[model samples]
Target: MPSTQRKKIVFTGGGSAGHVSVNLALIPSMQERGFETYYIGSHSGIEAGLIAGLPNVPYTGISTGKLRRYLDMENLKDPFRIIKGVAEAHRAIRTLKPDIVFSKGGFVSVPVVLAASLNRVPVIIHESDITPGLANRIALPFARKVCVTFPEAARHVKNGKAVHVGAIVRDELFSGSAARGRAFCGLSAGKPIMVCMGGSLGSAKLNRVIRNNLEKLLPHFQIVHLCGKGQTDPGLDKKGYAQFEYITEQLPDVLAAADLVVSRAGSNSIFEFLALNKPMLLIPLSKAASRGDQLLNAESFRSAGYADVLLEEDITDIRFVHAVQQLYHNRGEIKARMKSHDNQASLRTVLELIMQTVR
Candidate 1:
């Protein structure tokens, strides 16, 4: 018989919203199965704030250093920080004695994965992008199984470790009502709604371009712009457009009301849009700002007939409006493609894998 005792699971991921969202999706199911969940992450990172608010999951903050690809003075100090982080994580894991550690592939997760491996705890790492991030590549050796959203990613990982389980989407997302969303945003049913998401930290370039072309856009569509933290424009309070710094509890409603989406190509966000059947125009982060994972993610979506891609560096007001128009015209086809695929099965598969690993 399966053990009657409540098993413990440790989750480690952060740095970006994409890294943390998959962990959130699995938490409710874990709690229901009588698993005591704990999260280990950076002291003041976005994950700390996000995980701290969860009811039963106790979050432990450890010293973590960013794994940078470029030359920087901080890179020298970061190695020592990582060493300290590993020691701290090792101590935490030793005390917690979790049955397993689940990582969502962020810099903060590297130390935690290493610590878990050292303690002989099974670790599962999930990669959201088509390609593994540097952090995941570093922690791959320590992971017992590597779960991936894309089949292409499995090719990059060691043989037998990678599992293509699709993407984990929050259950609450399916419960959103378009009417309720419209009401929350104070929009009428007259115009199609376009939800513009720049991600948790926001995208200044996307925000600027959208605002600059609002005059042309508002006539055809109502806009709900999730402009990121501290990026809301105070002066541009115009009709047919609403701007929010960020949305948490009401995100589903906002998404439910959206007819089209203009957003960054984070794997988690795009997969959510796909599951929701929202046709999107993806403006990925430039290679200058990121490792071009978003660019790759956007391209994959475009190639798969899921979304329209617009390179950030090449965007102009005219081109931006034209792309949104193109996405709108092709919305029906995109929605058809999205409906043909159900990626939510990944949630159950991942949960089962975790259970199997624990047993």
Candidate 2:
């Protein structure tokens, strides 16, 4: 690669933090390596809100939304919107002429990935769940590289090459050391910390469970809870709960300080915890989600011994408390298991694969 001719990579995906965090991880590395990076996603999705106000980045939007689970009036408009989004993405693709398009699968990335493929530009699909999303499955045949978080997802790709790169993680989380993390997060030198999070936007079910179990959990360890954007204002009643709608550069501190985590098993969260070697009690949402990806992600991690999965419906106050106490008591074993599967350099692995296909 020459210095003057910068490699331009376009990242398109965002409806949830699971989709968005992949780009957040890969983009800085791409930029530091002198690759010109651009992000293409929907203005309507959470990407606009999260990516807005960030520096040294350019983003363009295409109209995009999820397809409903059950047949509804909304389905009628999706086809037209898909066509419109593709045309808009085609315009963006022509204008940007990116060296590669790295798409973390989501409905928002569908048209953009399709447009890139149509233009003969290499499209890389990164599926974060064990089971591919519907949109990603539809777009998989056209992608040059179908990068996946789990080995099991390889079964879903029919035409493209399936490469398991683990998960791309932001450097901040990747670099947080335990000792410094405790000091930074204001945790006592000896007390263990439990970090609870629901993705970027937060999970009401997880929040409710934590609230109910907080009193029992408080005596065991300090809690650093990421309540998600807008959801924190309802306020949790725990004596030592540190609440944040978003944790910026300090996330590494939070991850390092935690001995255990109770969170949604979204691909980003699961892999981040795995990289940090943190024990987690993963609460995957019901199969009734527009897509059942979360449940699949949880199952994969549980099977891999990286985390314990508990269905939200099956979780009770006593069960949640017991899981926390049980995991925290055996922290050494849990952390060791997480370390066994940790691929901290996964971001580089993913970038290398994309580079291979594109170059």
Candidate 3:
């Protein structure tokens, strides 16, 4: 058992950077409050690489399989993998005996949550989309509470477990220096900065459109592209255009310099942009590609006047340029509307909720 003097918390989420970002935001604060933290995720999932970037947080890799809706030969084997994952998670929870487990929902989390329940540990889940994903929907019954970024998401969680905690923006992002950002990217300050982010794994769609129209865009805007991991082009260099596979510590700085952003509508990324008041043009993943979560996220932001959306299916090289230019020209008005959102207490609220749950 974890005593108050030396408390422990287990965090589980993976598959995408979005799943693990909340844990990243909360981990430092939890450490500051004297809580020892541990992470449980799939061995080779995106979460492992992200968590590896952190110090002192021991990560436990467990067997986890993708929880898919469509039929596949692998689906037959997944149940066994998930069962094994549950056993591994059970062992991990029994050994750690943390005060509580906080999960940002993903397929990997289902087994962890199940193990936590078997061990009689409190589990809290956070959902970033307007609708709970299949994994979160399955885990909802096991959670003591489900924290949702979107108010609409609460409606999807059965029983009385849903809690609307808003978006948990990373506090470190507030300290970004635009000047430092410009210097680091080696981009000139003469033009407005436009940052294109394609989530963690990179969006091939976003990359192609941006690359194809660089000549048109770079003349008007200094473009900084976060092309996800291993998506950068080495020989395609242009002045006033910078490409990075990912911006780790310098992300805040890069964002600070951004006059506007073009991004996939991941809830965490969009909310951070909203908190920063960055005008945006969102290109959500098509419903054909995703479960329509990003499309919903982008539409919500669009309806709220926080962003302009050009559907992924509608993207053409010229349309991409036109959309970027449109967002750029109207950024001042868009930023003014963005000021309507109040996100100052999101981080505090989630932290407080975690402590209350632990006690």
Candidate 4:
């Protein structure tokens, strides 16, 4: 911790919002402790866009290849790209000389984690699903520790390095005002408000279903639909329904005003909803679109009594409406169960582990 040689950390995660959010949560804490922070991610990936504007965190983009389950023409060329990425990442890490590297589990993280291992830097990777994704599966052997959001995920790590630390909920999410949120949405207190999120990239299937049922839903609840980028519908602009492409600074306010949530079953989003004690109807991504991680993430929350799940294939206008109604009816029970869990403790444990790894 000497001024001449400050502690340094490099965060590596990308491909989706879920991967980058955990790193974002930890950066401020790292900065406050006087550690020099850097981020390594894909040049054109979502991580690049997210980390580009953060002050004091230098972002270094490296070549990354997608790790896919299915066969693709790109698959033939990506392994070479991954090799190049590892070489580039190794060069960056060697120059940065970071004390530790933390990965939040994405295809972009594999090369970075491998490079960290090669450089003799300790690496910690967090898996947010019940089973580790393909990237994390590859990176696990190189990781000094594997942190998991679910206890079941820990058992599958095989390396015996897994820690069940729950989800890392960002601190800023709790600072929202209901009045401010209502005002921002121009909503009245007369009706309950429902917030629908289709993850950061948005869900086309979920978007269509929600819009199709808006008339049925609007009478019972005011709606704040974060319809993803370029998914907004101008024709559906009606009273008590607000559509946003995305929310950044005003996200907390939006969450604060929501009486219930309808969202995709991404671990970070569901965990954030749980932390806020909001009852949710989750529609997870199908196996065709993903590795079925969201399906497992949604099931885990449902089993824990924190949420209600509606599979993508099983969704219909009537079923979706019924699930929302059921969630509203049982919201008190859901909130009570959520209150029994502790998110702050999980954040503290992960932060302590990160700091401990560096030392």
Per-model TM values vs. the true structure? 0.96, 0.90, 0.96, 0.95
Stretches of candidate 1 off by over 4 Å are 1-4
lDDT score of residue 357 within candidate 2: 72
- Candidate 4: segments with Cα more than 4 A from true spot: 1-4
lDDT by residue (259-310, candidate 1, tens digit) is 9999999999999999999999999989998888899899889998999998
User: Whole-model Cα lDDT per candidate?
Assistant: 0.92, 0.80, 0.92, 0.91
The TM-score of predicted model 4 comes to 0.95
The residue-by-residue lDDT of candidate 3 on 273-302, one tens digit each, is 999999999999998888999999998999
lDDT of 4 by residue, 1-359 (tens): 54578899999999988999899888988899888999999999888988886899999999989988888999999999999999999999999999999999888999999999999999999988898889999999998899999888878898689998999988889999989999999999889999999988888998999999999999999999998889999987799999998887789888999999999998988998999998999999999998888999998899999999999999989999999999999999999999998878887888799888877
How good is model 2 by TM-score?
0.90
Model 3 Cα shift for residue 10 (angstroms): 0.4
Residue 339 in candidate 1 has what lDDT? 98
Candidate 4 Cα deviation (angstroms), residue 335: 1.3
Error of 3 at 289 (Å): 0.7
Indicate whether candidate 2 or candidate 3 has the larger lDDT: 3
* RMSD (CA, Å), each prediction: 1.6, 2.7, 1.8, 1.7
